[model samples]
Structures are given as C-alpha cells and as structure tokens.
Target: MIDLAPWAWILLAIAGTVVGLSKTALPGANTVSVAIFAALLPARTSTGALLLLLVVGDLFALLTWRRHAHWPTLLRLAPAVAAGLVLGAVFLAVAGNAVVRPVIGAILLAMVAITLWRRRRTTAAPEGAAHLGTTLGYGALGGFTTMVANAGGPVMSMYFLAMRTPVKVFLGTAAWFFAIVNIVKVPVLAGLGLITVPVLLMDAVLVPMVVIGALFGRWLIPRIHQALFDRIVLILTVLGALYLLIP
Candidate 1:
C-alpha cells in the first residue's frame, strides 16, 4: 500500500466530498479536489486515483440528471474531444506535472474571461446554438486539460456559461459528459500504470464522503437561484484557476 500522512488522508477525504458536490451541484468546484490530490500524491497517481472517485461521482450525477442531457450537443463535441484526448495522452507521455498544471491554469483563466465577456455582449444577437468552431475549441481544451490534470469541469463550465444554457441543462449535460469521459480514461490510465491496488484501496476509504456530498448537492441545488448560481460558479472557477497558477 502507498503510505500517506494522517493530514494527507484528511485532505483527500475532503477532496473526495468536493468531487461529488462538484459533479452534482457546482461544476467548477472540483478543481479544488484536483489541486488537493496532486498536492498530496504523485501527479500521475493522483490523476488515476481521482479518476475513479470522479466516476463514482459521475454515477450519482447521471442518476439524478439523466433525463436532461442534450445528445446533439454531446455529439457535436465528440470529434474535437477525441483529438484533444489523443494530444493530451502524448503530452503526458512526454511531459511532467510542473508543465501541465500551469498550462491548465492559464487555459482556465482565459476561458473564464472569455465567458464573462461573452455574457456582457448585450448587442450580440442571440445565437440559437453554439458555433461549431466554438464547440470544437472548448471541447478540445476540455479533453486535454482533463486528461492531463482533471481540470475539465471549469473549462466546460465556461463553455456552457458562454452558451447561456439553463442551469438544469448545464448540470445534466455536464453530468453525462464527465461520466462517459471518465470511463474512457480508465483503460488509458491503467495502461500507463497509474491505476493500481493501492490507489483503489485509498479510494475505497474516501468514497463514503463522496456519497454524503452528492446527497447534500441534491438537497442544495434546488435552493440556489439562477443568477446566484452563475456568479458562484464563475467566482469559484476563477479562484480555482488562480490557485493552480500560484505554485
């Protein structure tokens, strides 16, 4: 088994809970979990361990929001996402976490800024659907960031915000997207020898916290107003991105 200090375990448990809450309620919040895990473990190992927990969280999100997914959007994003995943895999094979993390942080910060600017464009005509180029750009970046650092949530959250998706639809589509994407990453991580018995054992200890967080999210989501939810997500996204850039 991999050894960790007591404090590390506590941090991991908190991160697991945040992962669940992020999946079900706040899309961008799990960046905190990604930061915590990477801080406490080898970056590659942390990515694998956290992937399993994210899948568990994804299951909960899918169960709650299955009926709300918009398949056409998912389909439109697929090709670019696939290209990004491949690019990320190659990058991971060649690079280290020190390089990866900062890149992700920069991308997230830029996306947040772009999203906010898009929202403020009062004179822009309403685009009924996201532009193909926009979808591909965000999808590719989301896939790349997620593959390297588990930081896709905020990237995609910015995309959805720019698109002006309804809150429920945003959550629902994100739920489905992550669930499928996390599952796809499993074998890739396993091939890289990142997922192992020690990681699984650690995850087992942390999963109950994820369940508790998911339940809390279910209860809390309906209570948040749309405007407040939007602001909260954007603020958290910015904070998470800044945290990544700091070190």
Candidate 2:
C-alpha cells in the first residue's frame, strides 16, 4: 500500500474532485490538481496516478460533450500530437523530478501568457481556418505538456480560444482530444513503471470524488458567463503554475 499522511490524503481527495470539474466544465483548472498531486506524491508517480484519475474524468467529459466535438480539428492535430507524445516520453525517461517540476511550471506560465495575448488580440473568429503551423505548434505543445505532467489543458484551451471556438464546441472538442490523448499515454507510463498496482488502488479510492466534481461541473457550466469562465480558468492556471514553481 502507498503510505500518505492524513493531510496528503485530504489534498489528494480535493485534487481528484478538481480533475472531474476540469474535465466537465473548467478546461484549464486541472493544472491545479496536477500541482496538488505533484506536491503530495513523487513527481513521476504523481503523473501516472493523476493520469488514471484524468482518464476517468475524460470518460465523463466524453459522455457529456462527445457530440460537440469537431472531428476535422482533431484530425488536423493528430500528427503533431503524436510527435509530441514521443518527445515527452523521451523527456520523462531521462529527467529527474527536480527537473520535471520546474519545466512543468514554466510551460504552464508560458501558456497563460499566450492565452492572455491571444484573447486580447481577437474576440473575432480566427482569420480564415487554422493554419498548419498554428495547428502543429499547439498540438505538439499540448501533447508534450500533457504527457510530461498532465498540463496540456491550458495549452489546448488557448488554441481553441484563439480560434474563437464557441463554449459548447470548445468543451466538446477538448473533451475528445484529452480523452484519446490520455488513453494513449497509459501504456507509455506503465512501461516507465510509473503506473503500478498501488497507484491503481489509490486511484480507485479517489474515483468517486471525480464523479461528484463532474456532476457539479455539469450543473455549473451553463450558468457561467463565457468571459468570466475564461478569466477564472486562466487565473487558476497561473496560480497552479506558481505552486509548482515555489518550493
């Protein structure tokens, strides 16, 4: 069994709840959960453990938003995302926790800046369709961050927002994107010895919290104004990033 302090368990439970809420309603908020898990567990182990809980959250998101996904966009992003996953796997194999944590923090901060800049530049729809360069850049970054530390939400959220995706469509597309990407990561993490019997057992205990958060997200999403929702996600994302950076 995995040993954890009482306070750690309490924090993990809150993190699990946030994972579900992020999937179902707030797209970038899971960065906070990632920060919590990483703080409380071994960095690499936390990635694997959080990935399982995220997959569970992904399922609920998919069920709720599957119909809203934009397939063409997903297809466009596929190749770059795959390349990024491979790169991330390589990075994970060699980097220690000391290195990984700071890198994750940097990526999150960068994404937040990019998101704010993009939002300021345009409330209008993206000029023409998404360019190939833009697609590849966002796809690869999203894939790499997600694979390394489950921090892809903010990166891809910025991508969708830059494209001016409507709230429902954005949720749907992101739901499918993360669902498939996260599942693909399972075997890679398992091969790294990050996913193990104990991790699964721990996740089993936390699954219900994820479900509750998802349900809560579903109820809350429709009520939030889009502008307010976007600000909240970005602000939470910044805070999460800072947590990783601080000792």
Candidate 3:
C-alpha cells in the first residue's frame, strides 16, 4: 500500500476531482490535474493515483455519453495507439519523466504551433499524413506522458482539436476512449509497483470528489462558448507542459 502525507493526499484529491471533470466534460482540462499531481508527488505514484481517478472519471463519462461515441475514429486510431502504448511501457521500464516530460512537452508545443499555423494558412483543418502522423506520434507520446506524469491530456487534446470534431461528439468520443484506455493501464501500473492495496484504499476515500467534479463539468460543458473553451484548453495544455518541464 502507498502512504502519503496529509497535505499530499489533500492535493491529490483536488487534482483527481478536476481530472474527473476533464474526462467527462472539459476534454482538455486534464492538463491541469496532470501538472498538479506531478508537482506534488513522485512521478510514478502520481501516475498511478491519477490513473485510478481516471477510471472513476471514465465510469462517469461512459454513463453519460456511451451512445455518442464515433467508433470509426476510435478504431482508425487503435492500432497506432496500441503501438504507442507498447513503446511507452518499454520507456517507463527504463527511464523516468525527468527527462521525458521536457522533450515531450516541447514536441506537443511544436505540434500545437504547427496546427495553429495551418489553421490560419489554408483555412482548412489538419488532415492526411500530418494529422495521422501526429496521432501515431502523440499516441506513443500520450501513453509515455501519462505513464510518467499523467500529462497526456494536452497531447490528445491537440489531436482532437485539429480534427475539429463538433463539441459534443468530441467530448463523447473522448469519454469512451479514455474509459477503455485508463482501465487497461491499471494492470500495467499494478505490475510496476505503483498501485498497492493501501493506495487503492486511499483512492476510495477520494472517489466522491471525482464524482462531484464530473457532475459539475457535465452541467458546465454545454453552456461554454465553443471557441473560448477550445482556446482555454490550448492555454492549459501549454501551462501544464511548462509546469512539468520547469519542475
């Protein structure tokens, strides 16, 4: 079982709450929780704890939007995502995020910059190789970042944003996608010695916070201005990336 100081547990609870909502309603806000949890705990432990909360959030998300998912998009990306996950597992077995986060963050930032630039240039959405390549690249990177720091939100968010999905389909598809992925991570994290019985126990104490946050996000999401919400997501992604890199 994992043990943490009181303050650390409190901080984790808060981060978990936001992460829950990010999964269900605010698709990009995950960067904030990743930054918060990584800043407060050992990178490995933070990854595990965040994974637990993600599962909780995943449950809420599926319950809310299970029917809304775009399964074709998810399937199209599955093979690459699996390849990325395998690479990420190998990386986590050898190195920590102290080296990974900065490199990955720089890459994510570059991707976002390129995406934004393309948006202004052709007035067309990102597509073809660049888009699919980013999917493959970021899929591995996403698994790596989440394995190390729970920081994949921005990476995935940028991909979804570039795809320019309608807001509801975007949020709904993300909900189902992450539900499956986060659950898969559980056994992986347990094998890595990051998840213990005690840690699971502590996680139960914080489940309520995740629920509340998800509920709040559910209510708040549809009400938000689409463009403004997307921009906020982008800014948070940058901030979350910076937080990990600098720390």
Candidate 4:
C-alpha cells in the first residue's frame, strides 16, 4: 500500500461518501467515485481498493432497498452477466484500464443517446428482446469496465432507465446488484494481484464516510420526487462520462 498524501486521503473520503450516496440515492454517480479513485492511486490499485468500499456501500444500499428489488429482472440478467464477466476478465488481462476506459465511456454515451432518442417515441418500458439485449449489452459493458476500472454504474443506469422501472426500484435493484457483484469481484481482483494491504487500510478509514453517505441518502430519498431523482441521475451520468473523456 502506497501511503497517500493527506489531501489525497481527503479526496478519497469525499469520493467514498459520494459513492455510498449514489448507491442508494442516485444510481449513476459512481462514475465520479471511480474517477476520484483512479486519480488518487495507480489506476489498477485504485480500482481494487474502491471495490471494497463499494461493497460496504452496497450493503447499506441493499439493507435500505432490498424489498424493492426486482429479482425477476436480476434472474434474467444472470447468464448474460456471467458471460460478460468472463469476457471482462479476458479483456482486463489482455489490455490494462487505459484502453478499457475509453470503450466504457463510449458505451455509456451510446446508451444515453439511445435512451434519450427512444424517450420521445415511447415512455412505455422496453420488454422482451430489447430488454434482454439491454441486459446482455449493458451487462457486458458493466463487466468489462468494472473489471478494468470500476466504472459500471453508468452502464447499468442506462439499462434501468430502459426498463422504465420506478425510481425506487431502479435504485434498489441496482444497489443489490452492485453489492453482490462487487463483493464477488474482490477475490477475483485479489487473484489478479490488484488488491493490497495498504489499500485495505485506506478502505478501513473510508468505511465511516460510506456509512455517513448512506444515512444521508436514506434521509434525502423520501423527500425528493421521483422525476427529480431520475433527472439528477441522468445529469450526473453525463458529467461522469465527460470527466472520463477529458485529459
């Protein structure tokens, strides 16, 4: 574990708190957390460290929203998600995150574009093939990006949008999904030699921040209207993509 400067730790704490809130209050803001982690540490090590913190946040999210989760949808996505994870593992080994980052950004942008285009034509939820394809496609995108860079939030957010899920369900289901998936990702990342003790220590200090953020989310969610929540997610996701694309 490389000992970070105090300021770096501060930034990381802020990022972690934001991530926790995003998991519960907003869905797509995690892209900012990933960016902050990557900026503060080595691209790969940062990815590993953030995964643990995310799982902590995930637990909080799941506890808050588990009842609202859409298990049928999660079931449909399972096989496709597995396939994507395998492909993502291969991609991570073959090409480091530098190459993976831009691809993830492009995918997110494409999803956003498609969702916006379809929004005018029909507010009705996508079903059947379109739904399955989205699960597979976004699952693949999420798996690949998360494997290499811990940046899957936006990809999954797009999928939730297409599903036309109610705001709480979207956030709840996404929280459960990421909590389980990020936990599963830990041992895999450890096997890949990305996780290290120093980072673990950092994760420890960061846990409280995640808790605080989760609490904040719990308080905030009931007050805000559903439409406002979705809009915030969309705007934050676009900003996250732009942040990734910038030098």
Candidate 5:
C-alpha cells in the first residue's frame, strides 16, 4: 500500500466524497479534490490515483445522466480534445513535481477566471449550436487541464455554461466527456508507472467515500440552489489553488 499519514488519509476520504459529488451534481467542484490529492501525494501519483476515483464517479454519472447527453457537441470537440491530450502527455513526461504542482495551480486559477467570466456573459447561440471556434478552444483546453491535473471540470463547465446547456444536458455531457477521457488516461498513466499496485490499493480503500458523496449529491441536487452552490465551490477551489501555488 502507499503509505500516508493518518491526516492525509482523512483528507483523501473527504476528497473522494467531493469527487462523487462533483460527478453527480456540481461539475467544477472536483478542482478541490485535485488540489487535495496533489497536496497530499506525489503530483504524478495523485493524478493517477485520482483518475481512478473520478472514473468510479463517472460511472455513476453515466448511469444518472446517460440519456441526456448532447452527442453533436461531443463530436465537435473530439479532434481538438485529442490533440490537447497528446500535448498534455508530452508535458507530463518532461515535468517534475515542482513544475507540475504550480502548473496545475495556475490552470485551476485560469479555469476559475474562465468560469467566472462565463457566468457573467450570456450566449446568443441556442443549445448545441455553439460556434466552432468556441467549441475547439474549450475542448482543447479542457483536455490539457484534465490530462495534467484532473482539473478539466471547470474548463468544460465553462464551455457548457457558455453554450447555455440545460442543467441535465450539461451534467450528462460532462459525464460522458470525462468518462471517456479518464478511461483513455488509464493506459497512459500506467505506461508512466504512475498507476501502480499501491495506487490501485489506495483507490480501493477510498471508493466507498465516493459512493457516499454521489448518493448525497443526487439527493441534494433538486433541493439546492445552483448559483449559491457554485459560488461556494469556486471559493474553495481558489483557496485550494492558492495552497498549491504557494508551496
């Protein structure tokens, strides 16, 4: 098993819960989980481990929102996202922990800005009719951020928001997008030796927490006010980013 202090384990459990919640209700909230894992573990190891937990969450999301996805938008994004993934893999190969951590922090911060800007602006395009340029830009950036730090939630959330996707469609589209991307990442991370026996062992322990969060998120979704919930997530994400950036 990958050894960790007691406190680290506690934090990881919490992060796993966040992962599930993000998958079910809030798309961008996993930025907090990414920061937590990165802070507690080796940056690369954290990425690999967290990817598994996110995959578990993705499964739940796929079940919950499977019928609601916007396939055309997904098709539009595929090429750019693939290109960005290649670029991201190259960067991960060369970057050290010190380099990766701050880069992730910066990406989180930039994603926050994008999300905030998206919230302020209203798009004229109808659903599933977003401009090609907008689709490609967000798709590429989402792929890169997700590959590097498992931090694509905010980027893609911004894209969906800009497209004025209905809540269910947004969640469904994000669910499908990450499910595909995270699975693709498994082999790449394994080739890099980031997904080891220990990482798998660790994820097995944390999987239950993700389940709990997903259930809770499902229950809370209808009752919660999204705007308020998003504000809270954004604040926590900023704090998490600042932590990684500082050290």
Candidate 6:
C-alpha cells in the first residue's frame, strides 16, 4: 500500500464512506470524495483509486434502485457521453493537475447556474420531455468531467435536476450511469498507469468503509424530503466546486 500518515488514512476512510453515501442517496455529494482523494493522492492516482471504490458503491446502489432507471434517458445520453469520454481521455492525457482542477470547478459552477435558471423556467412553464440539445450538452460534459476528475456527479446532477426527475428515479439513473462510466474508465486509467497495485491495496482496506456508508445512505433515503435532497445536492456541489477553484 502507498505510504500515508495516519491522518491521511483517516481522511481517505471518510472520503470512502462519502462515496458509498453518494452512490446510494445523494448524487452531487461525491464531489466531496473527488476533492478529498485529489487533495490526498496524486490527482491521477486518486481518480483510479476512488473509482474502484465507486464501482463497489455502484453495486450496492444497483441492488437498491436499479429498477428505477429510466432506460430511455440513458439511451438518449449514450452517444454524446461516448464522444465526451474520448475528449476527456485526451484532455487528461496532457493536462496537469493544476489545470484540471480549476477547469472542472468552473464547469460545475456553470452547470449550477444553468440548472438554477432552468428550474425557474420550468416552474413558470410546465416541464416537458428533455430537449435533445440539453441532453447532448450535459452528456458530453458529464463524460468529460467524470473522466478528468471523477467530478461528473455535480454536472449530471444538474442535468437530472433540470429534467425534474423524481428522487428514486434520480438515484437509480445516477447509480447506473456511474457504474457503466467507471467500468469503462478502467482500461483508460490503466493505460495511463494510474491504477497501480498500491492503489488496489489501499482500496481493499477501504471497501468496507464504503459499504458502511452505503448502508447508512440506504437508511436515510426514504426519510429525506425531496426539497431537502435537492438542497443538499446543490449545497454540496457548490462547496466541492469552490474547493477545486481554491488552487
């Protein structure tokens, strides 16, 4: 395992628990995990390590809410997401950590603004089917942000929120989206040499923490009110994005 101070391990354990909670209940909250791992480990190494734990959390999410997935929405996003993933891989291949963090932060902040504006309009005018352009735009951005920093959670949360998805459907869709995306990232990250044996070793020690968090999140989901859920997502997204922009 990679050498780390006791405090560092404590922080990672907390971050890992957040990962589980993010997967099971809150969507944008995982941005905190992205920030934590990025702060503690080399950016690229952190992405790979955090990703495996995310996959583990994804399985639990799937078990909990897989039936709620909106297949049409997933299908609609597939093409643009694939294109964005390619672009993100290219960007990650060349961008320095300093460049990656601020760029992602800016994107998340912009998405938050857009989501808020859309929510206002949607309130004034009844919601309808998601627009093609919006889907493609968010799809591409989600793919890029996820690949670059595992920070796609806020971006996609904005998208789903704009669409006014119900809470259970939102959790289910996000669960599947990240599960597939993270798995696809495996080969790309490995080729980039981010997934080392030490990373796996470290994650092995932390997987149980993720499970613990997932269980807690599952217990909390039904109790959380819809407005409270949305507020928490927005608050966490903004906080995580600001942290990234801090440099």
| TM-scores, each model vs. reference | 0.85, 0.91, 0.79, 0.82, 0.95, 0.86
lDDT of 1 by residue, 1-247 (tens): 6799999888889889888888788765677787777767766777888999999999999999988987888888999988888887888777677876666567657666765675566336345788888889989988998888787876787677667777778878988998989899999988887899999899999999999888888888878675776676668667766776777
- The superposed Cα distance between candidate 5 and the true structure at residue 94, in angstroms, equals 0.8
Could you give me the TM-score of model 6 versus the true structure? 0.86
Alpha-carbon error at 4 in model 3, in Å?
Answer: 4.2
The best candidate in terms of lDDT: 5
lDDT of 2 by residue, 109-192 (tens): 887787677667666647657888999999998899899989887678778877778878988999999999999999999999
Candidate of highest TM-score: 5
lDDT, candidate 1, equals 0.80
- So what's the TM-score on candidate 1? 0.85
- Cα lDDT listed for each candidate: 0.80, 0.86, 0.70, 0.73, 0.89, 0.82
* Local accuracy of candidate 4 as per-residue lDDT tens digits, 185-204: 88888887778888888898
Tens-digit lDDT track of model 3 for 1-247 = 4567888778777777787777667755666676666666566666777789888888888888888888887776678777766766666667675765565455446545654564475436566434667677767766665555555655666566667766667767877777777787788888887787777887788889999889988888768776776687678667756766784
lDDT: the better of candidates 1 and 5: 5
Q: Which portions of model 4 show Cα errors greater than 4 Å? A: 97-131, 224-247
Q: Which regions of candidate 3 are displaced past 4 Å?
A: 1-6, 96-123, 126-135, 224-243
Cα lDDT for residue 32, model 4? Answer: 64
lDDT preference between candidates 3 and 5, better one: 5
lDDT of 6 by residue, 1-247 (tens): 9999999999899999988987887665676677678767876677789889999999999999899999888899999999999998998789877887677677667656766776676555326677889889989988988888787876687778778889789878988998999899989988988899999999999999999999999898778785766777678668867877886
